[model samples]
Target: MTRGSLRRIPLRIFSGLLFAALLDSQALAAAPPEVPPPYIAAPAWVLMDHDSGQVLAEHNADKSLPPASLTKLMTAYVLFGKLKSGNLKLDDRIDISQQAWNAKGARLFLRPGSSVRAEDLLKGLIVLSANDAAIALAERVAGSEINFVAEMNAVAHRIGLDHTVFMNATGHDEKGHAATARDLARLAAALIREFPEYYRWFSLKEFSDGRITQYNHNALLWRDLTVDGVKTGQSHSAGFCLIASAHRDGMRLIAVVLGAQDENARVEDGQRLLEHGFRRFETRLLYAADIPAVRPRIWMGDQSTIPLGVGRNLYLTLPRGWHEKLHARVTVRESLNAPVQRGQAVGTIALDLDREPLAEFPLVALKQVGEGNLFQRTIDKIQLWLQ
Candidate 1:
């Protein structure tokens, strides 16, 4: 081969290598983003966003299993609803019944005939996971534990807990008395959202009734600064379970770990799930509620255009640093006729990421628009026909 041809051969080889490198770079850039599910040592688990009800991650989240003390969450919810509706008062006294006194598992150590303040029992029920306190409160509201279990089931159904069934108010293990991690997550979010005033008790590290002092079983509260009130349950059938919530940077997340091997496993696994969630994903306000998102042209209306917007603020949970990738498309009818009522659904607003819809909401009229005068309608018809 000629010397010059040999030199050209080296240059050609270098160019080929450079082209291959560029192709590899392009392939990496085009790859889809990944947020792998965390490794949690539990039979069933779920992590969710508080504001949006978005399930960030899960494994066996829908499987029904023993919930142990997490049943107390329902008990607390029932009492809170009563407090809100004036059926029960915080200071109202409840006479402990024989059944409540003989209740099993963790308890407030109430005597059969002794009277305890309803508020104090709430403190015991929540802070100590007191079986006695749960029963006493149940009897106070429903006259018996069986009736109170019925009330719990009714509320559970209303809140969309399809997999949850309550045999007793204290969360004792029994056939058919089970709840899934997803349902428990929903219950936790509802408890926080529905009773903000009463949720403060969950954050209390310790509660005292002038004799015995009980600390919250949720260790996350002391370990993580953002961790707040929640419930933990442990039983031979259920293993160890914890439902915890944490708030950071205006975002709140609920974590549930069920059937862990032990208390430490539950706490560690719960914390790992929460940290994985907060670290790997973030919550973003996609669009403000009640703010005009778009104004579409109106036909045969007193106004030339009608304001369109979402009814409530739209929030989305996405992989961290992915907010900029979100895009929204407004869909509306070809023409709108007036007498449009405010809040009338006229169209839909869809949110997309990577060209796929992640969520959608109804687009509604922001203001009422009356029909135009007959002459105006006629003119509009002529204009449309001319076009």
Candidate 2:
């Protein structure tokens, strides 16, 4: 063949390869099935895996709205903190003030000048959503409701709840008393994490004083065995709200719903979110803080192999049905130099299910790997040069 013909042959082959690559790309793009949106009817909602903090579903989750009685969750959190700190005792008696007795929201029938223990007040607030009980507790804790509200806001800031503002511990529908579903979920998470002992109060289906019995507002507790505690709320402007948590198969999930039409709607939507999470997803431990997940090569270092670990516990929430399809890929430098400190990011551990990356965590050096001596360095350099 002539010189021009020879060049044209290779050009034609290259063009053919390029065209085939484009077609493959288009075909692959088309091959991926579209994922349908979650089934939800709430105006604002969020569902997250408790252990992994994986967001399973969200709809206007950041939109601030009246929290109603769900604001009590933060109140409960603050009270629990005081209890844990020994500043308040559950058995300590509280005198009901006129302000607490005159509170307008839900009531536990607390009478002014009556004495009730702190634990009993907590039961009233959590189980009955009693405004009187909340006010009494607030005043007892901080000397006034106004002062208690300042404490609530301070705790909110410390917990990273940026969108929440508490005007009343009872979650009354004040003009500026508002929070987002995401914030409420975060509050729930904090409650679960910080005061696990106190969280049991949320699971009480029925609580009673000597004269009367009050049932919990959360209906899911009776219907679902997995569901334990959380809170619910309702008001004219707030619509209906519910924060529900369930534990199943060693996985815990939190669902928050806001702006539903009624109690039934709120419960139903919350249940749906919880069901979707538990049925569809699972929690997998990817790595532990001190446990090495990968072994990275070391060059010009004191050690031949370096252990790579996660800085914190790594947990992933992925599709339950896709567990068999899960795969892990650890990417690290073929060889690392000395002076590697503990907790320094050495690489990444990527987790994939169904060929899609679900989560990625930083792989860090588990221990300090120092620079090698002159003799070892010379040997490593010689070996690398030979290769």
| Most accurate candidate by TM-score | 1
Which one wins on lDDT? 1
Residue 129 Cα positional deviation in candidate 1, in Å, after optimal superposition = 0.7
Over 4 Å off in model 2, which ranges? Answer: 1-38, 295-306, 333-341, 352-359, 367-387
Worst 10 residues of 2 by lDDT: 11-20
Q: Candidate 2 residues 202-318, lDDT tens each?
A: 999988988899899999999899999899898888998999999887778899999999889998999889888877777765555666766656777888677876666656555
State each model's CA lDDT, in order.
0.83, 0.79
**Cα deviation in Å at residue 54, candidate 2?**
2.0
Q: Provide the lDDT at 199 for model 1.
A: 94
The alpha-carbon deviation from the true structure for residue 144 of candidate 1, after best TM-score superposition, in angstroms, is 1.1
